[model samples]
Structures are given as structure tokens and as C-alpha cells.
Target: MSMIKTIKSLPMAVAAAAVLAALPMPEGTPIFGEQTAFAQRAESNKKQSTRKVQALTADFHKKLQKAQEAIDAKNYAEGMEILDDALARKANDYERAVAWQLKAQVFYEQDDVRGTISAYEKILQFADSIPEALEIGIIYNLGQLYYSEEDFDKALEYIQRWQNRVDPTLISVSNLQFIANLHYVRNEFEECLKYIYQAIEIGNSLETVEVKESWYSIALSSHWELGQYEKVRDVLEILLINWPKPRYWTQLAGIYQELGDEQTSYSLTEAAYKQGFLDDNETQLVNVAQIQLARSAPIKCAWILEKAFKENRVEKSPKNEKILGQCYMMAYEYEKALEPLSKAAAGDEDGDLWFQIGQVQMQLGHYKDALDSFASVIKAFEKDKSEKAKEKTLSATMQRGQAFTELKRFKEAREAFKTAKRMATDRRDKRMVTQWESYLKAEEAREEMLNG
Candidate 1:
């Protein structure tokens, strides 16, 4: 997340200070004759001390200049050695800052992030002696440094210091975003929201400011974690307008669904689906279709499923095909339901899809076709010994008996009902099968009476 890098030359201190300092200390001889030699000695010592300070000051500059050159030449170790000596000899705060600034540059050039941070922070110790611009840079670097170390509180502290010192007009979008990120990384969401919004607001105003997608997403995530759905809605609208990806559209629809606004959610997803943004993603396609089903728009739901099925976009798995068939059935389009149901039943070994196909055909008064589908269900389960499969086989046998009765084939119907009764294991299924057999017997007796 860090982007800050490289270095700027330390603001030069006036080199002429060496010349002025090199001048002899003000001459002072004692007025007392008794202490004249002692006075001379004191004066000599004072002058010597002054010269020593001047030499230190000059030597510090010379070393600082060489260190800066080494840094410029990309010789960080050499630059650091000279800077260490410069730091040792600095005669005042200004000289110390010069050495510290060079040290920071050397560390930064060596790609030692932590060491660079130390050097920059050390420069701030003499803030009174540094230019305002350089001081602001140091403060900003402290924020960047602590942010790199994941010490968010100190990062924010330094960033806030920089913000307080500088004019509001001087604060850039990148700076605000960095401050916002520090708050975000620390889980201080509310504080994060404040700076990020301003960053976005500022970024929106300037063509040069590239407001990245992360800025908006961070806002969205914070709002979501806070359970501030309305804010989430607002940010999503802006995101949809700015960078309209399918995930964003899907999430926006989901937000509406969370609010119990199913119709709106379905409409939004339908719109994206129609615009082709959701096509490549099967889950998104199914989501859009499911939303319609949830909204009671079964006809529209069926149309979407059928169209995707036709385009081979939605998988033709039995599960998917059954859903398509169910959508048509829910819309009262039984004939339309049969096509996908037939395909679903074709390769299905468990017989569940075949049962559904049988029911739809029976509803459409296709008794023979219904009987055939029901037979497929029983045949599929005959080899399976699972109790669940036995129950399904029994149910299919009963359904087939009904289809035979529908076709007026009384003998076949009666035999089918008896088989179903024999196969029934559950008492409820056995009772139901017995009831159907009694009805078949009564119908056979009536037919015999009519023939006689």
C-alpha cells in the first residue's frame, strides 16, 4: 500500500557561517594586574575553543557534502559512513539536521525502510532549524513509516500532525487516502470513512486525481461492517456509475434484497443481465433468474432460464434442467415445462426428474406419454436397493396405475395397482396403494356389469 519513495536534497544552510565563525573570538584581557597571565590563559583557551567549534562546523559540512555526493552516486554504505561522522561533529541543530537529512537519504537509497524512517524521524528532532517544507516531509514520512510497520496509531498521529501544520489547500488526495487507510487498517471504520469521503470528494474535483476503485470499496466495506445499509447503498450507486462491473451490480441488488425489496433487486439484476454484463457468469445468470422467481415473476423467470438453456450458457445438468422445468410449471406452462423436464429425465438415473416429467404430462392429458415417463422412473430404481429408491419406485408404480386408469385400460391398471401395493413398505404408501386397488376393482366390476 505504500507508494512514497526516494529523497530530496536537504535545504542548504548558509555556508558563510564557517567564515564568520572562523574569525577570532572577541579579544578580552583582564584589567587586574595580578590575574593578567591567568586572564591571558583564559582568553587563549576561549579562542582555542572557538577555533575548535569552527573546525568542527566546517568539517561537518565537508563530510555532509561528501555523504550527499556518495548518496547521489548510489554508494549508500560510503554515504552512511560520512553521514555518521557528520552527525558526530555537528556544532548546532542546523548542522545536525543536515547530517540527519543525508542519513535519511542514504538509508532510503539502500532500501532500508525502517532505517530510513529512523533517520527521517531523527531529522525532526531539529525541526526548529529545518525549512517548513522539509519538516512537513518528515512528518509525512513518519506516517508512511509507521504505516509500513503496521503501527497504525503512530502513523495516524504523524499524518494528523502533518495535516495540522499544512494549509488545507495544500493537502492532496493521495495524502488524505493514506490517512484514511491507516484508520481502516486499524478497524477504526468511522474515522476511515471521514477521510476517504473527503479524498473522494477532492479526487472528483480534480482531473489529475485518479480516484481508484479501492477508495470506494473501502467506503463500502466500512459501511457494510457498521451495518449502515443506507450508506452502503449510496456508495454502491456511485460505484455503479463510476465502474460498473458485474460484482458491483450483483452486490447492489443483494443490498436491496437485504432490505426486503425483492422486486427492485430482481429488476436491477434483470437489467444487468439484459445488458449482457451477467452472461459469462453462470451464478450471476442463475441469481438474476432466482430473483425473478422470488419476486413471483415466474413467466419472466421461465423465459430467462429457457433462453439461457437454449444458448447452452446454463448447464444442462439434471438439477438445472429441473429448475427450468419447475419455472415453467409454476407459470402454468406445462407443455413448455415438458421439454426441459424430458431432457432432465433422459440421463437421470435416480428417477426424480422422470417423475416430474410424468406429472407435467399427466396435467396436459397425455396419459400414454405420462405412463411411459412413469415407467422410466420405476425401471431406473429397480436395480437400486436403497430404501429411498424403493419408496420412489413404489410411488412411480402408483403413478403408472393412475395413467393406465386414465387411458381406460382397467386390467393393466388393476395389475399395476396390485404391484404397487406389494412394493409399498411404508404403511402410508401401502394404505394409499390399497385404496387405489379398491377403486380399480369397483371400476372393473362396473365394466363387467355393463358387458353382461
Candidate 2:
């Protein structure tokens, strides 16, 4: 199967916001903070050295408060003007960082992502003056902002930086998933698998957590990109268990087929069909029927096709009709096969389908109908000079003789056998024709005795 087609079939989130939303935010912190708390705190235990807490100047504090009030009132332009004036006053690192933080809030409120990114970048320039937690949060937000901008390389860079600084145990499943998706968009399948597995593991361990469906989708797609069929199958099975959607079932079946496990593939496809998952999918329905026929479940194949035809799900084209007829014939449902076979035969220019129709009619003991089918076959091949056509014409004539014999029409049977003998180039065909002629004589004798 083409991975591109499979990828296209998967239901996945298209928005970068979905990726951002999937990440767990700090307990009370929004995904994108409008304001960073300027009050300083001690560094985390993971940090070797604690940075000194920086306090905002009383004058700058008053200015920042005024800016916050304007922003809160939705007077964004007024808020930006005050912050720009405060920054122009030659503020210290701490005061400058605080001013930029308020500026970011204004830009964010204005829905200016680029402006917000610029303000946040300025705050990072005073990284040492800001609290460690606040700095880390800014880094994480920058990654998400870059993602929203579709700058995947920068997004991965900043997110990885945040991951390096934070405690692994504190990372949420959604955060891991966000990182995994970043790797996925970068076409780094191996890296994507690493983070996705971590996310799944974390998600599984938490009793209250329900792993997001997109997490498994990423795993499945990554494994496929890496050519890991077994892992892909495993992920698909998990997805089927948790989600139980039609695409998962079909995708898992396809994986099994790629692994050369046709039996399992057929079983999955048949199960999906039984659940009516394949009903709305015309190609999948036909595929399931074909698999059934290949697996020697001709009756099931015939029934499926028959129902699909009635429901107008599958097209009633000549090729499809022939398949339906063949399925019924294979299952020894000769009476059921006759109609489709005859319809298919009528649509076909070559006499092959007509020959099949004649054979089915013979099996059903409809010798008169069989004779007519054989006549049609002969007529179809009358003008064709191909060797195969000649062979088929000869076989039809011989069957025509048998049909006449079954009807006790001894004179017509003799003529059919005679014609067959003249057309026979092979010694075996000649011998068969001679035997039919002898059978015709016995039929004549039997008929006479019965009449007496």
C-alpha cells in the first residue's frame, strides 16, 4: 500500500492550535501568557545556581500598572504607548523585562503573533534578570508561537530547549505528544516515534488519562515511514481496541497483507464487512468480496456482491456481473448464477462469458436454455479467426451436441457432432466428437424403446 494514501485516510488534526492545546499548561498559566509575573522566585532544585530575585522599580511599577489597566480596558494602543515610554526611560534589566512582558500582553491581545514573539524575545534578552520559571515558560511559549507560525525548525529547537531544562517527571503526556508532532512534521520519523512512545507510556500509567487518538495515529504513521510493519500493525491494533473506527480496521488489514499474512487480512476485512464498516466504501466492499472469493468463501462473496448490487453500492457493470456469476458458479449455485452470467454474456463482445453461461445452464438441467447459450457462443466467435476463438467455437459446438442429446433431439445432435468433428484440429477433440455421436445413437434407441 502507498503510505501517502494511508496517511491521507487517517483522521488527524490539521491545526497547530490542536498541538498546542494538547500540551498540558502550568496549573494556572494560560498556553500563551498575556503577562509574566515579575515577582522573582528561587530557581528549581535542578538548577546548580539560583539566580537572585529582581524587583521592579517603584516608578516603573507604577508605569507598568497603568499600562496593564489600559490593556485590560482593551485600549491596546494606549497600553503600547505607555510601555514604549517606560522602556525609553533607560530602565534596568529587571524593569526592561517587565516592560517587554506587558508589551507582549498588548500584542497578544491585539492578535499580533509576530509582535508578541518580538516582545517575548526581548524579555529573553534579560534571561538572567528574570525568574528561572518565568524564563522557561517564555521558551515554551516561543516554541508554540513558532509552531503557530509554521516555522517547524524553530519550534522544535525551542521545545527541545525547554525539555532539556525541565524535569522529565513533570512533563505531561500532551507535552510529549506536542514534541512528537513537531518531529513528525519535520519528517524525523525516528525522533517522532521516541516521543510518541514516551507519551503513550505516560498516558497509560495515569489511570485518569485517556490517551489522545492522534497520539497513536502519529505512532502508526511514524512506524510506517520507518518501514516498521510490525510496529505499525501493533499500533493499529491498539487504535482499533481504543477507537474501533472503520479506517483503523481497514488499515490494520492492509498492514497484515503487506506482511504477507493474507489470512489475517481477509479475516479482518470480513469482520469489518460484517460490522457494516465497509458498506459505505465501495472499493473496500468489492475488495472484501474479492478476498472472500480468493479464500474459497464463494458463497459469502456472491451474497455480498448480490446485496451490494441491490443496494446500488457497487456498480452493475459487465465486469462486476461476471465476478458475481463466477462466485455463484464456484459455490455450485448454478440456478442463481444463470441470470448474472447471461447478463454478463450479453454485454461481452467475446464468447467467453456466453460459454460460462452455457455451462451453468447445463448444470441446472436447462438443456434448451443451454442450447440457446451455446448457439450464442458460436455466433460470437463466427467471424473471429484467432486460434483461441476457433478453440472456443469447437468447444461450443460439442456442448451444443450434448444439449441436443439431453433433449432427445437425435437428428440435431448428429448434425452438431458432425460439425464439431469437421472443426476439430486436435486428435483429442476428434475422439470426443466421435464419442458424442455414439452417445446420440444410444439416445435415439432409448427414445424409440420408450415410445414403444
* Tens-place lDDT digits, model 2, residues 1-452: 33223222322211211111212222442332222221111133355345674555667767877887887789988988998899989678877876777777666656677777788888889988756666766777678777767789898889889888766656667678878888899999999999989988988888987888888898999999999999999999989998999999999999999999999999999899999999999889889998988988999889999899999999887788888888988998888888887888888754888888888788878999999899999899999999999999999999999999999888888999999999999889999999888888888998899999
Supply the global lDDT for candidate 2.
0.78
The alpha-carbon lDDT assigned to residue 349 of candidate 1 equals 58
- lDDT by residue (tens digit), candidate 1, 56-98: 2545556755776776678878887876776665267767765
| Best-performing candidate as measured by TM-score | 2
Compare the candidates by lDDT and give the number of the best one.
2
Worst 10 residues of 1 by lDDT: 10-19
Task: Report the number of clashing residue pairs per model.
Answer: 0, 0
